[model samples]
Target chain A: MSTVLLEEEMTDTPAAPARLLSAGPAAPGQEAAWEQFTKIPLPTRTDERWRFANVKDLDLSPYLQPQPVDETTREELLARSRGLEKAAGRMVFANDQLLSREVLSESLTRLGVVWLPLEQALVEYPDLLQQYFMREEAILGGQKFAALHASQVRTGMLLFVPRGIEIDLPVEAFHWLHGANSSCFPHTLIIAEERAKVTVVDYYESADTNAPGLACAVNDLWLGAGAQVTYVCAQNWSREALAFQINATVVGRDAQARSLFAQLGGRHVRSESVSHLRGPGGRSDMLALTVADNAQEVDARTFQIHEAPNTSSDLLYKNSLDDAARTIFSGLIRVDPGAQMTDAYQKVRNLLLSDDAEANSAPGLEIEADNVRCTHGATSGQIEQEELFYLMSRGISKRAAQKLIVNGFLQEVIERLDQPEIGARLAEMVQAKFAAHR
Target chain B: MSSLKIQDLHVRIGEKEIIRGLTLEIPKGEVHAIMGPNGSGKSTLSKAIGGHPDYTITSGDVLLDGVSILGMEPDERARQGLFLAFQYPMEIPGVSNANFLRAALNSRQSEGEEIEAVDFYEHLYEEMDKLEMRREFTSRAVNEGFSGGEKKRNEILQMAMLKPKYAILDETDSGLDIDALKIVSAGVNAQRGPNIGCLVITHYQRLLDYIVPDVVHVMVDGRIVRNGPKELALELEEKGYDFIKDALAEPVSA
Candidate 1:
C-alpha cells in the first residue's frame, strides 16, 4: 500500500530520536508538545533569534534516540560520575536512563522536602510538574529544540522545598552521553516556596572524549518571596558532540538568585539563559565562562527582564578562545515601565589567545522605566604585555604565564559566584580542558 | 668566576642607544651598589640585563656564573638564577600573590615536578612574616590596590622567595617612605650572604644607610665613571650628581 512505501522512506531518512517513556502510554501533553514542535519551522539566516548561529548543526536526521545502556556500561558510568564529595542528594543518568538516586536525609523528608525523578514525579505529583516543567516557552532561539526536549525528556530531578526550609548542602545531577550520534534530553525543575533556600549543581559530560552525541538540556528555577537559589552547570561534553542548553529563573519579592555556567567542551554549543525579576527587592546574578579551543563554536544568548519595581540584575560573561575557535555572545537587559529604580548591568569579555580566533559580542539594553540605571558593554582583548612579562620575569614559562593570565581573566566571574568550593571545582575542570590543548 | 659580569654592554631602545659600552662586576658574597642621577641609564642597565623586550643589547655579554646568558629569554635567564626586582612592580588583577609566587616557584622545578601545596604555604607564611607583611596579603591580587610602600615591600618579598644568585634592585628606594624603607632594607639584608651577588641601584643615600654596600660605582651618562668604598654613596649624596658631570668634563645624556 502507499502507507507502506511512506513508512519505508521514513526509515530510509532517520527521524528524531524516539521517546522512551516508562509509563504504559504516552502522556497526552507530550503529543501536543511534539505536535507543536513539528509545526515550528527550523531556524534560518534571516531569523533574528538565530543570528550568527551555525544552522548546519541543526540537522537532526542523523541522530537516533538513545538506546538502552548495558549493565556494564551503566555501572562504568556510575563509577565515573564523580562530583562534589558530599551532596545532599545525587543522581546519575546515562543515555537518558536514571542509574541511581541517593535519597535525602530522613530529617529533610520530614521537613517537607520532596525530591523525585521526572518520571516518578509525573506519576506522583503531576499537577506540580505540569505547573513548572518547561512552562516558559524558549524565548531566545532554540524554540524548536526546547519543544523537542520537552517531548522526549524522560529523566532529571524535581526538587521542592517548603517555606522556611534551607538545605545547606548542594543537590547534584550528572548526565552522561554514552553512544555515537545518540540524543538525550535532560530537564531539571526546582520550586522553592517563600523564605526557602537551596543550591544545585549539574554536570553534563560524555562517556568517551571522541564520540559524537547530542544533548538538549533545560532547567527552570522558581523562587517565591524571600527565597534564594544558587545553580551551577558544568558542561564538559565530548569535543565532537553538539549541545543545546536553555535556562530560566524567576525571582519573587525580596528573593535572590545566582546561576553560573561553565562551557568547557562540545564542538558547537548553543546556550540561552533568561532571568526574570518579578518582585520588589528581587536580585539576579547571571555569570558564564567559556574556554573554546580547536574549531569549537559556542553561541550564547542571555536576557535579564526587570518586571517589577526596585529590582536589579547583573550579568557577566567571559570567553577565552584559542586555536581558530569562535564564540558569540548576545545579551539584553530590559526594564519594563513599572520597574522604576531598576539597576541592571551586563558585561561580556573575550580573551583571544590566537590570531585566528574570533569573538563576536552584541550587548543591548531596552529601558522603559524612569529613574533606572542600566549599563552594558562588551570587550575583546589578548593578554597584556606587561602582565605577561611580569609573570614570566619570575621564571614562569610563556605557556604557564599565559595560563596564569587566562585564569585571572576568568577568575573574576568565578569569584562572583561566592561559592568557593564550587568555584574551585569549576576551575579544575577548566584547567583540565586547557591541559588537553597541544 | 662566580659573579654577574657585564663587559662592554651596549643597549638600545628603539633607534636610540641608551647604554654605551658599560662594564661592571659584582662577585658572589658581595653587595655592590650603582649610584646615579636621574636619566643616567641606570634603569636601562637593569632592564637590559634582565632581557626586557624593549631594551635590545646591541653588543654586550652578561655572564651568570661565568656562562653567557645573552641567548636566553627573560624567564630562562631568571631560571638561570638572575633576578631583577622592579622598582614599580606590576599589578596583575585577579591573580593572588600566593598563586603568582607558586607559579614562579613551580616554573623553576623540573618538568613533571611541582611544589606540594602545604609545604609551599608554610614557607610562604614564614617569609611574609619576616617582612612584617600581614597574612591577608597572600590572598590579595598581586599588588592590586596596594600602596606605594606595599609595592616596594612586595618586590622585596619576591626577592626573598626567589633567592637568586644575582639580583639587580633598580631604584628600590624610589617610592618607599622612611618606615617602609627600613623594613624592606632589613628584608633584603636578611638574604645578604655568600651565595648571592647584589647590585643595589639608588639615587639617594637613605636606602644605603640600612643596606650598606661593600663597594659603590658611580655611573655618568652610559658608563661607570668611578668606583669607591661604600662611603662614595654618602659623598655622592652630599655633593650631588653635578660633581660627577663636572668631573666627567662632558654633557650627561642618556
Candidate 2:
C-alpha cells in the first residue's frame, strides 16, 4: 500500500467538518440538536450526574473533525475490519465515512428485513426511520453528548426485522477512528417488530491504539410485543481517546432485550445505559464487561425502569482494573406504582489487579409498587491469593495465571449471553487485549 | 543424587518456627512415608517443598535432582518437576479441570507449544477412568463442589497428568472412607516407578495399609526421630504414639 496525503483528497473537496456540516441536518431533528448541544452546560464537579468523575477531563475542545481518508488507507481499514466468522451481514465505517457493506443474504432481504446504513435508510424508508430515530434525549447525564452525536453522526446502522422473523446469524458493524485528535459519531438503531428476534454486534475501534481522539456513540434497541433482541458493543478506541456511548432500550409486552458493552479501550470512557420495561411480561438484561488498565477510567451509569406490571430487568456489570486504572458503577432500579409484581436485580463486581487501582460502586432502588422484588449490590476485590497461587503452583507463570483467573472470573457474565459463538469471540478478543498488554 | 533432598530445613510462619531442623531425602524409585503426630510440621514440610509463599524457608535448602530449588518461584519449582497434592485442595470456581491440567502440561513445554486437544482429552479421559472419575469432571471447574473422595481423586488425577519427578501427598487419605482410600492408593501406586520419588504424609497407619510404603519415618516435635522399614507403621499402629515417647526416653542405641 502506498502512503498518500489526505490533504490532496481534501483539495478535491472541502475539509471533513465543512463537508459534513454543509450537508446540513444529516438526520431529522439534527439541526435543532446542534442548537440544544450549545445550550447544555459541560459537566461540573458539583453536578450529581457527574459524581466521582474527573469533570475537567470531559473537555471536548481538543477534538477536531477528522479529514477524509485516502483510498489506500480506506482499503487498508476495510481489509482489517474483521468480525465474526459467519456474520449474516456487516457494515464497516471509518471516520464517519462508510467504507464497505456486506448486504444481507437473499432470503433475509426477501423476507422484508431492511438492513442499510442510517443515511440510506432515511432515504429508502423515511417513514420507518423517523419513528425510532433518536426518539428521546439521553436522560442519564449524557444529554449533551447525545445531542452532539445526533448533530455530527454521519453513518451507522439501521436494522429492521419484521414480525416473527428470527435471524439466527448475527449482523455486525465496525466503526473505526483512524486519525489523531479527530472525532467520530457512530450510531446503531434496531427495531424488532412483534415476535421478531435478531442479534447485532457492533465494534468501535481505533486504527492507532495510542492516538488521541473523541468518539460519541448512540445505540437504541426497540423491541415490540414478544420481540427479542441481543445487541453488543465492543468499545476499543485508542488508549488516549475520550469516548461516550449512550444506550436506550425499550421492551414492549412480553418482549426481551439484552445489550452488552465490552469496554476494553480509551483513556476516559463514560457510558450511560437505560432500559424501559414497557409492558407486561417484558424483560431486559443489561450486561457490561470492562477490561481497564493503565490510567484508564470507566464511568458507567445504568437505570432500569419497570413501567408496566409483571415487568422485569436484570443488570450485571463486571470490571477488571489493573495498574492505576479506576472504575465507577452507579445503577438504579425504579418500579412505578402501576408496575406491581416487578422483578429487578442489579449487581456490579470489580476485580482490582493492582494496589493503586480503584473501584467505586453505588446501587440504589426506588419502589413505589407493591409486591415487588428488587435487589442491588456492588463488590470490589482483588484476585484471591490462594487461587492465583493454586494456578501458579501448576506451572503457569504469574501473568498467565492472572490472565486465566481473570478469564474465569469473567466467564460467568459471558455465559449469560447464551450465544456460544459470539461469547467465544468476545472472550478471544479480550484475550488478545491481555496478550497485547504483555 | 536423583532425589528430592531437604537438608536441615527450618520453616516458619510469621515469627513462629514450624519445621525445625527437618532433614529427609526420597530417592527415585522409592516411597517414603512420614508419620507424625499433630503440630509436628508434616504439612509444613510439603508446603515448603512446593515453594508456598506463606511457609518461609529461613535457613535450609531444598534440592530437586541435584540442583538447589530454594531460590525458584512456585511455578518454576513446579516446572522443575515437583508436585504437591494439597490435603485440602483448592476449589477454583471457573477454571475447568481439563484447562487447568492442560495449562500445567503446556507450562512444561517450550513457550507457545500447546498439547493437541484431541490427544489431551483422550489421555485425560483414560486417566479419569482409571481413577473412577466421571467423564463430566473434565468440563466441571477444578474441584468445585467435589466430595472428599472426589477431591483426593482429583489431586491424584493431576499427578497422573503432570507425571512429576517428585510427588508429595499430604494426608491423601484424610477424609476418605475405606473404599475411597483403596481407590486413591491404587491411583498413587500406578504412578510409582523407578523414575519417580514419593513422600506420603499421614497420621494413621490405615492409609499405610493400602499404600504400603517402603520406608517409614516417625516425626515428633518437628524432628524425624527414627527411620524404619514398612513394618514400623504396623508397630506404631499397635503400640500407639505414646510408646514412641517411652521409646525415646531410653538411652541411645543403634
Candidate 3:
C-alpha cells in the first residue's frame, strides 16, 4: 500500500505529441489538466474507498496510449456496430478515435438538437462545452483514473436537447478497444434543458478476444428543471482487459434522472457512480447489473447525495458471479442538513453461482437532516434449489436451468428500465455474454 | 402399443419408506385412476415414477415402453416421454408461459433444430382455447400470481402441449371447483388417444366421474389392494372405503 508516484508509471509510457493533450478543439487549458493528472497518486490498498479491490491489478505501467486503428479494422468495427433498430443518432469510437458517425432524420437537426462528437462540439459550442465538461470532482476513489481520462480522452459524444424538446428515439455511442496492450479513454457528456426528455446509451466492447487492453471512461450528465433523462451503459469489455468508469449526475429542480449500468465483461472493473440532487423535488434512480465469471472481478462504488429538500433517490445493484469470480458493492446515501423530507434507498443483491465465487456487499447511510427516510441493505444468495429443480423438471438441463434463473434474476433490473428497445438490446448482450462464457 | 408399468415398487423419502410393494400398469388408449385414503402414498407413487429427487426407489422399476427410467435425471426422464402434472405447480418468476413451454418442447427436438415461432403460437393458442385460458397467460410469467384454478389449468395446458407418451396426473383435481374440474377434465380427455397414457391419482372419487377412468384401483398402505372396472369407482363411492378395509382384514381362504 505504499504511495506510488505517477511519474514512475509514466516512465514506461512514451511521450506523445502536444495535440494529443487536448481532447477536442476548444477544451481550454488542457495542458494544465495534463500536468495535474501526473501529480495525482495511484490508488493503493490502504485507501478505504478501495478496501476490497485487488489493488495489484490497478498497475498501469505496462499500458501505453493506443495507436490509431488501421482502415480495415475501422471498417470492420463500423460494420459490426449494430444496436437498436431505430436510433436518433449513433457514434462509434475505437481506441479513443472516432470511427464512424450516423445521423438520423434531417428533421431532428432542424429542431435545434445538438448531437455531435466531442471534438466537433468543442469547436462549435465552446461555451456550452466549457460550462458542463467534467465540472464535478472525482470523489469515489477513481481520482487518479479520472485525471488520466481527462488528460488522454480524445473521442466521445455530446448530446444536448434544448428546452421543451423531447426526442422519441435514443441516441447511442459505441466505444471499442482494438488491440493487445492498448489503452483508450472514452468520455460522454449529456445536457437536457428544462422540460427536455432524452435517452442515451453507451456501449463498450473489445475488438478481439483475449486482448489485454485498458478502458478508462467518464460520463457527465446534467438535467435542468423538470427534465427527464435515461442513461444506459452496457460495458462488455473482453475478459483480459482492465476497466475504470466514473459517472456523475446532477439533477435540478423537479428533474428526474434514471441511469442503468450493465457490466458484463473486463477482467478487472471498477465503476464509481455519484448522483447529486441539486434542487427540490428532484429524484434519481441508480441501477446496475453485473455478471462476473472466470476469475474476473467487478468492484462498484456509488454515492447518493441529497442536497435539497423533498428529494428522493433509489439505488439497486445486482450481481451474478460464477467460477472463481468476485464482486464488491459499496454504496452510501447521504442526506445533508436542510434536505428535509428526503427519501433514499440503497440495495445490493448478489447471486453466487459457484462455491469458490465471492461477493462483498457494504451498504451505508448518513442522515444529517430531520424528517428524512433512508434505508440500505445488502444480500448475497445462490440459485434456489427448488427453482432449479422446477426448471429441470420441465426438461431443461442443469446448466441451462442455471442460466435461465440467472437471467430471470437480472431481468428485474432491465425491466425497471421501462425502455423496450434498450432493454431488449441489453438482454441480447447479456445473453450473448452468457452463451460465449458457457 | 405404449404402456407405463410399475413393478413391485418400494419407494422411500429420506429414511422413511413411503410406497411399499406397489405395482400397477397403465397402457395407452386407457385412462386409469388410483383412489386412496389420506397418507396412502398415492402422491409419492406419482413422484417416484417422475424421478423426483426426494423419493428414492429402494426396489422397483418404472418402465416407459419397457425401459427402466430410475437411472435417469428428472429432465432426462421428461424428455424421454414422461410427464408429471404436479398437484402444486411451481411458480417461476420472470419466465413467460410461452417461453417455458417452448423450452420444454425444444428439449424434445434434436440439436440445431429450431421451433417455428408461428406454428408454436398457433398450437399454443389452440391448446389454451380448449382449456379456456386467456390469451394473456402466454405472456405472463409461468403460474406467477395465478389463482388456484388457473395454476391447475396451466398444468393441464402443459400436459396438452408436451404430449408425453405417459403422464402421471398427481392430484390435478385437488384445488379445482366443480366448473374448473369439468374444464380441466375435458382438456385431459381431449388429449386421450392411442398415442398417450394417463394415470390419475386422487383422494376423492369426485375426479373419476369427470375423467371416466376405464379402470379404478384402490390403494391402501402403499399398495393397490383392489382394482376393477370403472363400475368399481361408483361402488366405492356408495360403499365407502370400509368395504376394502374389511375385505383386506379377512384372510383369503385358499
Winning model by DockQ: 1
The stretch of ten residues in a row with the least summed lDDT in candidate 1 chain B is B245-254
The lDDT per prediction is 0.88, 0.88, 0.87
Per-model TM-score of chain A alone? 0.94, 0.95, 0.93
lDDT of 1 by residue, A116-162 (tens): 88888888889998798888878998888888787778778899999
Model 1 TM-score, all chains together: 0.95
First chain TM-score, candidate 3: 0.93
Please give the lDDT score for candidate 3: 0.87
At residue B152, candidate 1 shows an lDDT of 86
Checking candidate 2 for backbone clashes, the offending pairs are: none
Instruction: Assess every candidate by TM-score.
Output: 0.95, 0.95, 0.93
TM-score of 2: 0.95
Q: Please give the distance, in angstroms, between residue B62's alpha carbon in candidate 2 and its true position after superposition.
A: 1.4
Is 1 or 2 the stronger prediction by DockQ? 1
